[model samples]
Target: MEPTDDFYSAYDDPTGAPTSMTTMSCAIENAKHMHTLLASLLLGRKKDQLVRCDIDASGLYFTAHSKGKSLQIKTSMVSDLFETFQYFEAEATSFRICVNHILDGLGVFGTSAMASTAVTCSYSAQEGVFSMVLTDDGVLAECSIKTMVDDEHNDCSLGVFERSFEGAKVLGHMILASNALHDACSEFHELPTGAAVELVLHPTSFASSSDDAMCFRMQAHTPTSSCEMELHKDSTAIVQVQVEATIAASFQWTLLQAGLQVLPVASESFLRLNAQGFCSIQHMLLLGSHRAFVDVLLCPDAA
Candidate 1:
C-alpha cells in the first residue's frame, strides 16, 4: 500500500513546524490550457500513476518520476496561468494525486468542449482527500481522489539540474525543433525496446571545418540494426548549438521517447548535457497564449 498521512501530524508554521497540504486550492478558469498541461504530465494510461503537486504562491508544480526513478519530469503552471489562485499557508505544501483522474474529470479530454469548462480544485487535509469540480455548460461533475505522502521522495538531489540551468556554460547545449526529435525517433523504429540512442555534440569544425561552432548528431542502434542522423545549421529543424567541448553519450531510447511524447503540442526544445553526462530537456509549451514549460531529466545509460 502507498503511504498516507493524517491531519494529526500536519502542523502549522507559527510555532516553527513543517507544513503539509493545507489551505491550498485554486480555480482554473482556463480548463482547456490545464487539460493540455496535464496531458503532458501523464506518463502512461495506468490509472494508478501518481504525480507530486507542490502548491505555493507562485503556482502549482507537478513532478513525476519513472518507475525506477531513472527519469524525472517537472511542469509548472504559474499563478497567472490559472484564472484564480489561493494558498493561505505561509509555507509550501504538496501531496500525491492520481493524474489520470484529474485528466478524465476534465471532461474535455480531446475536444473544444473543454473551452466551456471551468475547474475548481481544492484539498481537504483534515480528511486527506483532494477534490475537483468541473462545470461545463452548466452540467457540473465532481471528482474525489485520495492523496499520499512519501517522506523519502522530497529528498532527491537536484544538483545535476544546476548544470542544465547554467545555459551555454554546460558541456553541450542544443536548441532544436521538438518536431525534429519526434521525427528522428520515428526513423529509428527498428531499434526495439531497450535500444540505446547515442547523442554526440561536437564543434562543426571537427566535421565540416565551418564557422558554425557546434554540431549535433544522433545514432540509434541495436544488435540487428543501426541508423544515423545529423541536424546541421542548414536544416530548419535546428535553431542553435553550442559546445565548449565535444561529448558523446548513450541514453535509453524508451526513456527519451517518454519526454518526446510530452511535447506534441510544443515547438522548440532545449537539450543540455553536463560534464557528468546527465541530460535535461526543456520543452517550451504555448498553451493558449500563455507559455508553460516542461523540464525532463534523464540518467545516462551504461556504455
Candidate 2:
C-alpha cells in the first residue's frame, strides 16, 4: 500500500514558534509503518523506558541502554524515512523520552481504509514538552510527553565501522543473510534466563573437505543441556566470512538476543567482534528506496 503524505506544518508546533528553534521537528504519514519499525527497538517492558533521541539535519538516532545489562542499541530513522524532517538548531540536539509514551500516543487505529495517520513530533524547549500531533482525515489529537536528561555511559563503534569500542582490535567479522542468521539463533528461544551463548568460529580442521569446513557457529547452554549449529564458509546462507584466528566468546544470552528483534525485517546481518569480547551486530533494514540500520553492541558485563 502507498503510504499517506501528511507532513507537519509550521502551525502544528505547540510552542507557536517557527521551526527554526525547534530541537526536533518531523512528520511521517505511515503510522503503521513507524509503529512496526520502531516496535522492534524496544529492549524490555515499554513502560517508563527511556530512549535517547538524537536529531540532526539528516534524521533521528535512537540509542537505548539495557537496564543492568551491558548492551547498547542504536537505531536510526534517516531523513528519507520522514515526510517532513527539519533540524532548526545550528547544531544537533539530543533528548531522552519515554518510548512507551511515544508509541502509545501514535494513534494508529482506524487508519487502514481511511486516511492514514500522520504523526507530527517536535520538542519545545520553552515548555519542556515533546509534543506529538496525530492527524488523520479531519481528525486531530495532541499529546505532550516529558523529556529527560540523556546520561548514558556506554560507547560503541559500529556507527563508524571501525574496531569495537575502546580501541579493541577486530578479531573476526562476517556478513550473512539476515534470515539465515535468524534461523541459526532459533535455539536461543529455548535457553533459560541468565544463560550465556557462545559465538564460535573455526573450521572443523585446518584443511578439510568442503562439507566439513565450517567457519561460523553458535552454541548455547541451557539449564539441562547444550545445543550448537555450524555454518560452512561456502554455505548458501553466508554472504561472506573472514576469520583468520579462532573466535570463541560467551556473552549474555539476553544481550545477544536483543539485536535479533530486527532480523526478520533486515536484509543483511553484519557481525564483528574484537578480542575483548566486544561485539557488534548490525541489522540492515530496507526503507523504500533507501536503507536504515540498527546496531547492537555488547559490552564487558555481557562477556
Global lDDT scores for all candidate models: 0.71, 0.70
Predictions: Cα RMSD each:
6.7, 6.1
Tens digit of per-residue lDDT, candidate 1, span 1-303: 553321121112222111365466678766777777777766656666778887788988888777766678888889888777777777887777777767766753336778777777777666667766666655566666777763445434444444434543468788888877778657775668788898888754355456433378889867788889877666677787777688887888777777777656787999987776778899998877689888888877876
lDDT string, candidate 2, 219-303, tens digits: 8767697978888877877887776578677887777777677887889988876777778888887765667788887764444
Clashes of each: 0, 0
The superposed Cα distance between candidate 2 and the true structure at residue 131, in angstroms, equals 2.1
Cα lDDT for residue 126, model 2? 54
Give the clashing residue pairs of candidate 2, or none. none
Find the candidate with the highest lDDT and give its number: 1
Which regions of candidate 1 fall more than 4 Å away from where they truly are?
A: 2-22, 108-112, 153-169, 204-208, 211-214
User: Candidate 1, which ten residues in sequence have the lowest lDDT sum?
Assistant: 9-18
**Residue 272 of model 1: what lDDT?**
86
Please, what's the RMSD in Å of model 1?
6.7
For every model shown, what is its TM-score relative to the native structure?
0.83, 0.82
